[model samples]
Every structure is written in structure tokens, then in C-alpha cells.
Target: MATPRPARAARVLLPALVAAALLGGCSTTVTGTAAPDPAPRPTEGVGADPVAWGDQVCGALLSYYQPLSARPDYAGADLPGIKDRLSGYLGNVRTGIDTGKQQLADAGASPVSGGDQFRTSIEDLLNRTGTTIDEARADVDQADPNDVPGFQERLQAAEEKLRTIGAAEGLDQLGATPRLDKAIAEAPRCGELDALTAPS
Candidate 1:
């Protein structure tokens, strides 16, 4: 069987890959199908239960990620078609990032100690990813579709920027705090994240 185009075209487009980092998974494999939406988790403020708090955090990130990974495939398409599809994919990514940020804000301050730091780290990662994707989208918009070499070069540059998505510090610290570690491990929604990132 052939490799999925989204994985083949750009691994950065997969939210499961990013979620692996967020949920403390060491690695991930891209699947062509999008993971099912996690059950409706509370959108309100953090609760005393660390598991509940973890659910809120995981929910916010997964909400947008579900749609973000359903990227358009450009395999075998002409240059013009490829350009359009690629641009659309990036635009969707930007929209997903915006939605995730707002959702995180709405989820309010974390109840667990050091949770705020963890949340901030995620926000920083999203900010950096958003900036890089936005820049790449802009470049794609200006690229001449007829110029195959130039378009390919632009895609390569975008891929390079995206390869650095999960390098944020707080992610590595997910296991550092026992409270958070338990929450992330036991949260219902977080379990979904684990399933999505697990090799399939």
C-alpha cells in the first residue's frame, strides 16, 4: 500500500504528531484517517481534580487537531492544483491554531501547581508553529504556480519550518510533575490523544 499523501507530502500537517509531544508520547505514525472527535469535555475552568484539569487541556488541543489533520491531498495533481490545495491546507492549519488558542484561553487557569507553566509552554509552541505556517502560507500565496522549481522550493522551506513543531520545553516536562503526569495519563480525553498518536 502507498503511504498517505499528507504524511508523504508533509509530516507537519498531522496533529497526531504534535499531540504525541503534548501528551508525552515519544513518537507517532501518521494515519490517513482522522481520529474520531473526543467526547465533549467541559469547556469551563479547571477543577480541583487533576484528571478533570487534564481533560480540559487535552480537549482544547484535540478539538482543533481533529480537523487540522484532515488535510487535502495533492498527489498526482498538476502544479496549479497542488498550489491551491497546499494553500488551503495551510490556511486550515492557521485557523485550527487560532481556534485552539482561544479554546485554551477559555479553559482558564489551571488548578494544579505548575500547570500554568505547562499551559504557557503549549501556547508558546502554538505561537511559534502559527508564525512559521503563516509565513509559509504567505510565500505560497506569492509563488508562481507555473514556476515548478520555485513552488517546490517554497514547499521544502515550509516543511523545514514545520519539522521543528514539537521542540518546546514544557512538553519534555510533562512527566516532571507527578500531579500533571497522573492527570495526563488518566484523563479520558487524554486517552484519546494517546490512541491517536500510538502506532497504527
Candidate 2:
């Protein structure tokens, strides 16, 4: 019985030794098919979370548009963008008023008609905007007493459009950055709102 046990042990040892030797020999035997290492974790698009991008986009638009509406005569080719350009945007508003004035000049003293009425209204708005801004200098003057409702109505419509913009095209079509940037640059809210307010 002891001899049989030894023989059995030897048989097990012999196979294991042979297997070890085979392992050392490069390509001495073929391995059965293996499952293969899990595909390397994907590296593409690792840091592009849409929600995070959306928030960044939202914040940037808010910052950009905050002061734009105040200045309506802001018609320039583009912005300097070297410095903060807070004044540059104000310049745009100035340009918008200037452009309106230039058009009025070109019209050569024609009494205001259809579109002209809207233009005149805008000129008046430019003046009112200055007064409105002065009123906001202190909380006691939270809003301009007279222009408050008008100003609020204008900005409110704009804000409503801006608020819905992210949801409308979806973060997908415009994407986070460009979409947000587009809303700021084009001021779509102001576009439609202004058009509606303009002559029929």
C-alpha cells in the first residue's frame, strides 16, 4: 500500500514537472484558446461630461449677456477680446445707437415711418437705458421707477429666451460651449423680441 502511494505521488509530480518545463520552452506547446485580456479601457471622451459642460456653458453665457442688452447700439464687426472688453460691449451698444443715428441722417429728415418708428423707439431706449443703469447704482433704487417695468419687460423676454435656449436645441445640437456662446453672441432672444416689437 505504501509503494502504491509513492507511485501515485510520483505520477503527479512527473506531470507537474513536465508542465513546468514546457512553460519555460518558448512556444513548445500550443495553449488552448484564452478569453483574452479585457479590452483596454476606452480612452476616448473621458473628460467630456455633458452636464458639466452644460453648466460651464450656462455660466459663461450668463456672464457674457449680463451687460450686453444694456447697450443697444453695439454693432461692431467683432470684439477685441484681448482684455475683458467690458467697455467694448458698451461700445457695441453705442455703435448701435450711432448706426441708428447714421441711418436717420441718411434718411435726410424724413418724418419717422413704419420701421422708422422702431428706430426712433430704439433711440429713446438708448437714452432710457442710461437712466435705468444709473437707477440700479443702489439697492434703494433697485429698478428705475419709470423704466423699471419697460426695462424688465425687455430683459425679461430676453432672459426667458436665454433660459429656454439650453433646453430648446438641447445640449446636443448646439453642444455645451458653442451653443452657449452662440446664444450670447447672437442674442437670439433680443432678435425675436426686437423683431416682434418692430413695425409690422
Candidate 3:
């Protein structure tokens, strides 16, 4: 017996896919001094338990991403400052992702129903996200005003890849869970990203 091609691809490309999704750019102008926190919602539904668990994971992600989204334009800023800020932002994101994965594991949530794919996906995503963050920092260090267009292009590409993967993986369908759906919808920073990448 042989594994189906889609299964093989999912196994082989899971890391890359999750990484692309995590790195996908969701640009929004953050306002106010503080970002909104994830609110508590009732856990009720077919997958209510997992949905609740996933909310925590998503909350962790939003905390980091929301702040990063709020940061002023890094283009043409002091190179050293931009690099340092981006480095810090990436560090926070790394931490959040790790914590989110741990939370998911603790709750025994799986990307696929009754499968261990979520854990593997999170680990792979963390590793790749770290690398991407480093690369982004490097780009910042080397960036000039002329680099804006190229940088935007890269961001768009990453975002598109994430959107495609999310759709293929049925992440969009997860939004059917009321609580998780509301959390994502109300999230200040990740709202657009979640909408664009995850299924509605």
C-alpha cells in the first residue's frame, strides 16, 4: 500500500504551509495605546471544547501580532532601530507561537479531526517562523527607501500563500464555531488577517 499523493504532500509540506500562514502579512493600522484582549465566550457546539482551546491559542497569537501591527512604519526609519524593533517583535511572536502550541497540546487539539497533525504543524510553524523572522530582520537591517516595493511584494506573496493553505486545510471551516469565530472577528489586529487567511 502507498500513501495517497495529497496525504504525502500534506505530510511533506505541512511545515512549509504552516510557516507560510504564520508569516503571512496582515497589515492594519493599529490605534490607541493598548490592543484589545480576547474576550471570554461560551464553549458550546459540536467541537466546542476544541474551539475553546483554539481560542486561547489564537489569543496568544493576536497579542503579539496586534502590537506588531501597531508599530510605526519601519521604512526609512533608523536601520538599527528598525532591526532591533523587528527583532523584538519576532521574539514575541516566537514566544506566543510556542505558548499557543503548548496550550493546544495540553488541550489535545488536532488540525485534523482525531489526528495529531496540529502538534506537528505548530512545531514546524514555529521553526519556520523563527527563520522567517530572522530573515525579515536581516531585510530590515539592509532596507532602504527603495526597498519598500520589493518588501511589500514579498509580504503579499507570503500572505497569498497563507490564504491558499488555510483554505486547503479547512481552517476557514473552523470559523463556524461561534466563539472562535467571534474572537477572530473582534480581534483588533488579526481580524483582517484572519478573515483573509482563515475561512469565513
- Please tell me which predicted candidate would have the highest lDDT against the true structure: 1
- Steric overlap count per candidate: 0, 8, 1
Candidate 2 lDDT over 1-200, as tens digits, reads 00000011212322332232222201112122333322232233311322232232223222222334442232341222211132344344344434534433333211211222222443354444433323322212232324544434433332332222111111222212322232223333333333322322
Compute the lDDT for candidate 2. 0.28
lDDT of each: 0.58, 0.28, 0.39
Q: How many clashing pairs does model 3 include? A: 1
Ranking by TM-score: 1, 3, 2
lDDT (10s digit) by residue, model 3, range 1-200: 00000112222232343243224323323232333324333254312344344444444444434433443344554534444555465455556556655654554433223123333444455455545545544544454435655654544443343233221132322222333334333444334335323312
Clashing pairs in 1: none
TM-score each candidate: 0.70, 0.23, 0.40
Best by TM-score: 1
Question: Candidate 2, 82: how far from true, in Å?
Answer: 11
Order of all candidates by lDDT, from best down to worst? 1, 3, 2
Evaluate model 1: give its TM-score. Answer: 0.70
lDDT score of model 1?
A: 0.58
